[model samples]
Target chain A: MQTMVETRNLRKTYSRPDGSTIEAVKGVNLEIQQGEIFSLLGPNGAGKTTTISMISGLVEPTEGDATIGGFSITKQSMEAKRLMGFVPQEIALYPELSARQNLAFFGRMYGMGGKALRRRVDELLEFVDLADRQNDRIDTFSGGMKRRVNIAAGLLNSPPLVYMDEPTVGIDPQNRRRVLDTVKLLRDEHNMTVLYTTHLMEEAQELSDRVAIMDHGEIIAMGTQDELTQQVGEEDRLEFTIGAQEIAEAVFERIQGETPGVTRILFNPPEQLDEDSSVFAPALLTVFAKRGRTALPQILQELDSAGVEIQSVAVREPDLEAVFLALTGRALRD
Target chain B: MRSILTIILNDLQIFFSQRGNLPGLLVIPVLLTLVVGWSIGQIGGGGPTRLRVDLIDLDQSGMSAQLIEDLRAANDTLVLCPLDNDAEDFCRLDDEPLPLERAIERARTGRTSALIVIPAGYATALENFERVVIDYYSLSDPLQPGLVLQSLNAVLQRASTASMIPGVAGALLDNVISAAQLPPLEGETRDGFLRALYLRSQQLLTERPSPVSFRVADSDGSSGSVLDNGFSQSAPGMGSLYVMFTVLGGMSVLLRERRQWTLQRLMALPITRAQILGAKIGVYFTLGIVQYAIVFAVGAAVGMEFGSSPIAFLAVMAAFVLCITALTFALAPWIKSEGQANGLVLLLSLSLAPLGGAWWPLEIVPEFMQTIGHISPVAWAMDAFHDLILYNGGFRDVLPEVGVLLATAAVLFAVGIRGFRYE
Candidate 1:
């Protein structure tokens, strides 16, 4: 497949009010191919938005360039932008205008006009299932409705490549499912390239053709789901919810030594709920095993002999969450 | 360019569509223009009219009485206090006897436009061709011509010319008698001839234009247009005030646009930053022009003169609007919230409007204050408007004012474009 988007050592440095500098995106590089749904997964404040902002020409890179369809975003921004569309995280539409008016205005901004602009606006309203409410003011719409119209606005010019930055944020489950389906349709039916940024692991797992795990301004891992999950060596993860008191180091060593197929055991201490409360949240004990379901009975017997109280437990999962944990020694959210 | 215009049209549509903005743009300003336009007429006449002059006739002779009558004829607007009494004590006297000392104080304090005091022996001194004294007192600036003083001067000049005519005629008769070696003529014939000569001279002087004629001229020595029912004062004055209110209001809208991220979204399009900035500027400029147009339309209805050059009138309006639009952009980036921007709009519009002589002529303010009033761009605009509306100036007369406005606009545009936040 032809490369649809490329960035070379893209960096962004912001100056603080007190004259200090913080590097938000440091010398990052990426290549997204045509017709691929590439996802950048990272927790909040991980610089995923910043990198995508530079690539979309919404922000000027401190150093480096992004090329879209053989056009440099920095040097040939107009041409680069002509072949792309952007749906920012915010609802980014005029609240006073009707949904149709907002779509028509943005369509004109992308150089469409007259009947063509009107037709495209009508088509997008239908595509988003908002044709009935197209003439209603955007401010009067629900959060989900606004998000739908926002997506419709971004696709006004029918660009080949589109960037969606957390398009489903702050919406209900139904809207999230709909947004996911919309992304699938973009690639499956239209053969369009998509650069999607999200913090949710489930969203990446369900929609991405390729995934890049970003943390603190750098890409830590990249590849298909199968190729990436293999890094954890096929060990199904086991989770144990215990009482407030955690097992001691000796107990942990004993469990790892005696339990067959148990590769590693990790214990987390209880966490205080708040300053006003004496209640502490339950501690957690995670044990990774090759055959986690077969090994669960032995792991429980070891904990029972040590006089430990277990609240609940889960058997197995070798997914992106496990991959992120294995690679960074922390959960995706952490 | 089409994109720029499209953006401008969109913004204007948004601005006009809001129901809350109508009063400021249309209803309030038009009503204020009518109020201000008529209020000035109440203070004075339709234009520059009557000034009160207090006269004390100490001589009480025919000559002094004649001087008083001549003063009235010289300028009908000079209403002599006490002699020409009315219910309104325009002379500022509290019905007290106007002793010479009290009258002097009135002139000194500007309670009256001026005071003319004739000495007790003025008529006798004038007839004998001896030195005559007339005390003229006022608090008016000597540099600016005082109309009351001119009226008094014309009366005094006629009196002096009358006194000299007799002396010159008497000398000429004596010279003719000596040269011809003839007997002396009778005193009756000689006195009658001199008296006849004085009467004819007075008639000729009266027939000619008075030295104190109220024909106002420009600094360039051109005749001026008269004010029509005070619209000259109110039309441009209120027009400028409303222009500030309308244009500075853009600050809040610009801030709201940024907060809503509509401005940021525009940057993601194929449009250039220059186009966006140009369109934003154009929106405010067009609104300002429309604001002026509305008020001036009322002015036209009320029969206000726009001087000789409509083109210069338009140039003044356009330049002023551009300067204000630039001002709106230059200050927009510093505003953190829509409320702050709204507060700033009110503060600037109200304060700058009055400071720049939109409420009244800067000439009425103190000299130092007039200099400071120019700090507001409205002052430059008002100056240009005054040149055209009040002074009957053409395009050339307003160039300096228009140039200042445009130059200021360019500087502000540089600052605004440099500091404008797109995201």
Candidate 2:
């Protein structure tokens, strides 16, 4: 029940070269439960890094507070830093040192020593699948291999809470998958709380138990996938082919009034359909019958009189992508 | 503490892991000690040190010729060139002359040292029992010129007095015989008188000698070589210059630690920043002490003797180390990169070495230059060292320098710590 990571009205402001202020992070308040894999999603420069930096104690908040493992990040910096392992956006490992040496160096920095330190380093290396490359210097490794070692170094001391900021950036697909799998394994095996930040919505959707979508330094939405999807709820979408031009106003109104499941209605007049349909009456009859709305002969008669063309009709369920689009009013990618 | 130890150990490992970096570090210290130490005491070893002096034959008599021969015999070290020849063989060979334009061109184009000229009637006046004036044409001002002239005059005086004694003794013997009213005798008497007079003149000339006159050019020579008076005495002083360079290396290590983010990682542990800084300073102090010990021991082995108390020497060296450590810390804020730190360390350490009397003694420098040297911690340290090594002074003599160094170190340490950043 403990909150592994928490922020209260956290805000950070940076001064620009033109003497203007940019609010990098603003009024972010959230609680991440212990051993939970929490993912934060945002566009580039959307305060994701700033928020992580504040929580990790790498940067001080311009206003408000953050805590890691029950210790205030600002007041109890060392204690908070001790409890949280931060894998920065950039690889911080020394390129000249071998994997084992890099691991040992970071491990010892956290006060780990002796046989225990060696054991931790070995375990972490094995988990990252870089056991074979453990003795080779990082400069010699490929991008994927180096990334694996980078993750391994972060896991050296085995802090209960680890924050990975774009951990799989600039890596091959194979390595990216390896990193994602490793992160999942670490959580499941060690019961470690993870607060991961990425701009990839799919990555967040796949790995996060709960996601907080940040935009322009604000958390626009935060919830489980179901809860957020329900934000655009599972509406029954019904599409109808109605042949109409002039005489369908009353019929359309009647249809709208009668159907309780129709979430949206689009009426394209017969003339608007690009079809080989000078025969509007036959197409209309077929469309109504196919829809099991044959009892509504008045609508067909009205569509035939209006000379409307009926091509196709269908209904589909609202998906998470739709929900995100509905909430943000822009494609998740754009 | 453990975290700091890890950092230090890791740093040491990284430093030694590379075959190149280790050799570079080791070579710098060794090369500086050996090359600098060996070259310190060597004065004009590649050639001769010339003294510029003018020759004036005021006597112009046969007696003057004898005087000149005696002068030449007195100090074979003197190169008695004629008036027409420029005595600035050292300055001329260096290609640098008195004028800045000429000196620059010559320095860029040729080689030389100094100039000497002879005034007319120098020997004639000497024969007349008047002081002969011989001009020394040098671009240097009074102090060096005056000192060289005094020493040269002493040599010349001994020679002239020896030459005059025989003539004076002959004249005195003739007077003595006449005063005794001895009758004019035959061939044996004349021969006997001549032998007695010759022997007596020889004895008189050997007994007492007259002083010689030496005149120095009143013009202050712009050629800086005139100030190159103390190479023989300043070699040990030069050796002290490099102590700062070694200490500066310790500061560079601090810069590298910060740049590498090792300090930040260390601070994340239980250890405080102050503790880490203290450990670094402590290590550097230890290193400095060891370096000083080796240098002093080696110096002693090579016939450089210290004062009665070795404690004074050790204390002065410790003070020097402390001062350098402080200066290094002060420079920490200003050095943004490892390359910059290294460059600054080299430039500052080398530049200050000469100014601080590490290359030469302040005693031989111009008055203003001596005053300026007081501003250098190395200067204060060198002065204290000189007291210990050259004068055999005890702790009391070095206390002032120690206090100054301690104060400077304290100030610099405070500033350096204040300016330090983890990344």
Candidate 3:
């Protein structure tokens, strides 16, 4: 496959008023192939947006360069920008203008005009399922509707590559599903390369052909789901959702020592609620074992005799969540 | 270039769609233009503007009344306060009697141009061949007297001339009688003849134009009496004032675009940053022109003459609008919020407009004020406008003013382009 997007030591730094500097994206490198869905998954403030912004030519890279279809973003910005469409996380449409007007205006900016521009705008509106409400102002539309229109705007030129920066943020579950399906369609039917950034691990697990997990402005891991999970070894993860009562350390020690095929055991206490409230976040106890299904009954009997209140229990396989936890000693959400 | 035009069209469409902008753009400015124009009253409103002079006829004698009539004939621009037909109190004095002290105070304070006191026994003093004094009170400059003082002097000089004529003629008659060895004529007959002679001389002097009776005209030889109500002043004056208001308003809108992230989105487009900046500048410049056109149309409706070259007029308008638009951009980057932008707009517009004499003619102010007024771009624009509309000047005459405006615009555009924030 041909390379659709590539970066060489891409970095960005910003200065504060007191002459202090912050490195937002640190010496990052990435290569995305044509006709594939690539996702950068991380928590908030992990330089996901910053990396995307640098690639889209919205911001200048401090130390290195990125290329869109081999066009350098800094030197040949106009050409690079022409080859890709950028969907910002915010609703970038003019609120006072109707959906159709906003689309037409952006289309004109892309050097498309006359009847061709109008027809393309019409098609995008229909594709977004907002054809009936095209004449309504964007301010009057719901959040999901505006998100759909925003996606349509980026698709106006139909370039070979598209970058969507959290397009499903602040939307309903149904709209999120629709947006995910739309991303799949872009790769499946249109054969267009997509660079999608999101914090939701589930989103990355579902849509991405390949994923790069970033943290603190660095990519911690990258590969297909199976390949990334293989790094943590073959061990089934057993999760026990427990109550506010703390499990004795001896009980955890006994589970790993006495239970056969059990490799390691971990416990995460629930976060403290306010003093006045009776409720608290449930704690979690995870156990990794070679044959987790064979060891589940023995673990439950141990917990019951130790006076531990088990709210729920589940037996799982080694996945991205488990891989993240094993590699960094932190949960994916952390 | 096409992208620039497209952005300009889109922004302008958004500006006009908002109902809140109409009053500032059209209604308030037009109404204020008409109101301020009518209040000026001088040129062609069909309402004659004349200096008010309060006269106290202490003599209440026939000669005093005659002297009053002569003063009127001396200068038509003077509207003597409290005339016999002043039923409407044209002097703005409510029905109270005008005292000599009060009239003197009025003249001293410049509330009235001047006051004239016709002393008692003015006819007896002239008839007896005695010297008499007529009192004049005014705040007019001593070295360069205004119309009121000049008219008073001319009328008084004629009165002195009339008074001396009889005495000189009497002395000559006596010399001729003695030399020819003939009897002297009767006193009553001589007195009657001299009286008739004095009246004839006074009539002749009053009938002729007073020394201050000349009409005002422009250097370009245009009729000074060219009929334009105050619209010539008010139209361009208010137009420039509101141009600042309308164009500087873009600062807030630019801030809004940034806050809404549309500006960032536009920067992400294939177009260059310069094109986006140019389009934004064009938006405000176009709005400024629209504002000027509205006021000028009202001026035209009232028959205000736009001097010899319409192209010069257009150039002045364009240069001024561009300067103001550049000013808007130069200040937009420092704006932190919509409220701050709004406050800056009002502060700059209000201060700059009046400082440059948008409310009235700069000529009416002091020499030092006129010099200081040039600190405002509106002053230069108003100067060019006055040359074109009032002086009947051509493009060459107003080029210096236009050049200054464009130069200021160039400087501001430099700073603005350097400091403009896209995100």
- Chain A only: list TM-scores of all candidates: 0.94, 0.76, 0.93
Q: Candidate 3 has which clashing residue pairs, if any?
A: none
Candidate 2 per-residue lDDT, tens place, A199-229, comes to 8877887788888888889998888877876
Rank by DockQ, descending?
A: 3, 1, 2
TM-score result, candidate 3: 0.74
Worst 10 residues of 1 chain A by lDDT: A325-334
Candidates, DockQ? 0.57, 0.21, 0.61
Candidate order (lDDT) = 3, 1, 2
Show the lowest summed lDDT stretch of 10 residues, model 3 chain B.
Answer: B214-223
**Which DockQ value does candidate 1 get?**
0.57
The window of 10 residues in a row where model 3 chain A has the poorest summed lDDT is: A325-334
Candidate 2 residues lying further than 4 Å off, grouped into runs, are: A14-22, A232-334, B44-264, B276-346
Candidate 2 TM-score to native? 0.61
Q: Model 1: iRMSD?
A: 0.9
Write one digit per residue (lDDT tens) for candidate 1, span A218-326: 8888899888888878898898888788677888888788888889866668888899999998887888899999889988898898898988989767888777777
Best-fitting candidate, scored by DockQ: 3
What would you estimate as the lDDT of candidate 2?
0.63
Q: Is candidate 1 or candidate 2 better by DockQ?
A: 1
